[model samples]
Target: MAKTVLITGTSSGIGLAAAVGAARAGWHAVATMRDTGRADALLEAAREAGVADRVQVKRLDVTDAASVATCVSEVVAEHGHLDAIVNNAGAGFVGTIEQHGMEQVRSVMEVNFFGVVELTRVALPHLRASGGRVITVTSIGGVVGQPFNESYCAAKFAVEGFMESLAPVAASTGVQVAVVEPGAVTSEFVNNVRLDVPAMLAQAGPYAPALRGYVDHALKSFGSDNAQTSEQAAAPVVDALTADRMPFRIQTSDWARDFVAVKLTDLDGSAVQTEMTGWLG
Candidate 1:
């Protein structure tokens, strides 16, 4: 029998690509999103790839505890067993701590950090039963903080620390855990942040010039040719699902690998701070 893998945030970007890729690889892909109404793109892509039969759509709001529990329970009950879970559902927030309110910061943590924790907590029992793995799509920001992305980076950093600490413990129980960090990828994720540059700069007050500088830098970075496509970034996720040995940390592209390396080797953390300082002009 083919194995099953459940993935969150399948409406678009890396999540959509990974869900389709997993189905093509012969795993029953439970492609989930907060709103199932947006699954058309995923289903169409899967159909074009000839993996529609292997891809199933489900509703999963990662930020909701009950939603997490119900989705995992229903998957196991219907599929008999779940071999893997890819926690790719996430949102992005772009602002300095002074610019955004505490509620906004907490909202970021709710989706990016707490959501991953809740889903993993709910899935661990079934994963242990099947000796399966947990794959989370964190970001390079998780390793190295970026300018104007305080809340986003903080949430991702929490996820990296959580998964890093959980890996060995999960292994002791016959389950594996890994975090996939991707640099800037061409995806709806950026657009979904809904950054109104002019309005934000106007409201930034003391932080306006720095905010403007950071926005310019970010636009150039995302528009650069070095940016990975969603599909390219999702490839590592599918690989981790089937690999004989998945590392505790996985970078999706060479760019991502080199980017994160700066932090790993920065003994005093000066290198990363200096590099990020450039973003603020």
Candidate 2:
């Protein structure tokens, strides 16, 4: 029997690419999104890739507990078992601390952090039963905090901590847990990020100049050649699921690895702060 993997946020970006990649690699791909109505791109891509027959588009709202349960249940019901799960259903927010209201901050955490927790929590049982894997599509932001990415980075940081804690415990039972961190991927992600620059600058008031400069720099960095295509970014997520040697953490690119390493190797924590200060200011 062929293996099966359910991936979230498959309407676009790395999630869509991963779903199609898995199908191409011989896994039954349950490609899910919040709105199945917007699955045209994934379906079209799958058809072009000759993997449409193995791709199934479903609706999954990871932030909703009932929706999460139903989606997992339905996938298992259709496939008899779930061999793996790709927690790729998340959005990004970019703003300074007070630039965002408490509700907006909570909203980011709900989707980016709690959604990963909810889906992974619900799917762990099925994964355990099948001796499966969990691959979360986190950003390099998870490994380090950046200016203007306060809330988004915070949420990803929470996810990194959560998954890291679970990895060792899960391994004893034959289940693998890992996170695939992508830096700037060339996808709808930049366009879709919840960033109201004007509003942020307005709310920023005192910090406006610095925040504006940082946003400009971040945009330029994102548009650079360093940005991985969605297909390229998804490769690590696919590997995290199918590779024989399961790694606890994997990044999509060397740039991402170096960007994250600054924080990880910052034992004194001053170097990263000094570097970020230069960029932010």
Candidate 3:
């Protein structure tokens, strides 16, 4: 019997690659996106990889509780059971802390942190039934700090902490939890970030140079073709699902491995919180 793996954010990038990769690897790949109609590229990729028949596209907005519940239930109803889940549906928010109001921070966290948590909460019973794997597609920023991405980094950091806390609980039930930390992968995530440039920020102040430099570097690095492709990042994520052995933390690129190693190798919650004080700014 073929295993079934459901993944989110399959409109494009690593999520789409992972969807097709799972199908090619002989799993029933349930590729989900915020809007099913936006999955043309995912469909094409699956077709080109000769995995279209094994792949299904569904609509899911992970932040919406009703949508999350209905989607997971529907997948289980259609497939009989869900063997694995990849929480890859997330976006970026780039702005200074002062520029981002509580609403902006909450908006980012709703999608990046709470969205994954709630969806997994609803899907846990199905996954637990099969001793399935749960993969959270995080970024290097999840482990380390970057200047201009306070909101995005905070959300990822929250995800890391949540997954860490949930891992032991899931282990008791035979469900394995792992995180994929990709570094600067070439994706639309950079261009699509919600940048809330406050009125004060538009006038240029003392912190303007630092903020501009951080944003410029992030945009240039993340948007460049020279960066690792989303397909490359999906390799380790797929490994996290199918491999006989899994690590709690799987870094995708060399930069990610280095960054996560330095940031997360020794620090626990207290240490991380202390270190991240200056970063949340």
Candidate 4:
């Protein structure tokens, strides 16, 4: 019997790649997204990899409480147990503090922070029963806040804190916890980002020049030759799932590892502020 892993946000990008990758790696992947209607690409990729029979596409809207509970229940019911779960369903928001209304912040939090908590909470029982693993897809921003990515980064940071805190307690039950943080990956995530550079610049007021400079630098870095592809980003998630022993934090690349290490090793923390803020005009 193959191990079963349920992953969220598989409509495309890393989620899609992880599903197919896990299937090829010999896990029965329950690839899920808010809309299973968009599963064509994932299914096709699974077919191409000759793992179609091992992959099952399901609908799982992480933000919906009932939906999260139901999806976890269904996976357990179908497989009699779940071996792992990858929390990849998330959205991004780009704006400064003044530009983001409270509602906007809450909306991003609902999906990124609260959604991870919801699914992980519901799946913990089954995971404990099976001594399963939990892998969350976070971002480098989660380690360090960015200029205009206040909301998205906040959400990631909150979830990172939650996971780190839960890891100890979860270990007592024989459940492993890990978070895979990736830097800029070539994915539809960029296309879906709620970015409004002009609008933000207009409202940037005294912060305009600094905001614009940071945005420009960030965008340039994202398009550089160093950006990881979705497949590359998914590699560490597969590692966490299949490795004999998993680490608490796994960065997808050296860039991500170094980027996050600064935060972890920054004692006073003011050094990081000075460095990252220096990117602004």
lDDT of 4 at 167: 98
Report the lDDT tens digits of candidate 1 across residue range 54-128: 999999999989999999999999999999999999999888887678999999999999999999999999999
Ordered by TM-score, highest first, the candidates read 1, 2, 4, 3
Candidate 4 residue pairs in backbone clash: none
Per-prediction tally of clashes: 0, 0, 0, 0
Better of 1 and 4 by TM-score: 1
lDDT tens string, model 2, 1-281? 98999999999889999999999899999998999999999999999999999999988898899999999999889889999999999888777776567898899999999999999999999999999998988888898888878898999999999999999998888899989999998645458785677877887888888888888877778788889999999988877777896888898999999988888889988988898888875
lDDT value for model 4: 0.90
Query: Per-residue lDDT of 143-181 in model 4, one digit per residue for the tens?
Result: 988877889999999999999999999999999999999
lDDT by residue (tens digit), candidate 3, 148-252? 678988999999999999999999999999999888877565456645445435754776766666655665777775478879999888888889857888888
* TM-score comparison, 2 vs 3, better candidate: 2
Q: Provide the lowest-lDDT 10-residue window in model 1.
A: 184-193
Roughly what TM-score does model 3 have, to 2 decimal places? 0.90
Residue 186, candidate 3: Cα error in Å is 1.4
Best model per lDDT: 1
TM-score of each: 0.98, 0.97, 0.90, 0.96
Candidate 1 residues lying further than 4 Å off, grouped into runs, are 187-189
Kindly indicate the candidate among 3 and 4 with the higher lDDT: 4
lDDT of 2 at 228: 90
Stretches of candidate 2 off by over 4 Å are: 187-189, 194-196
Looking at model 2, which ten-residue stretch has the lowest summed lDDT? Answer: 186-195
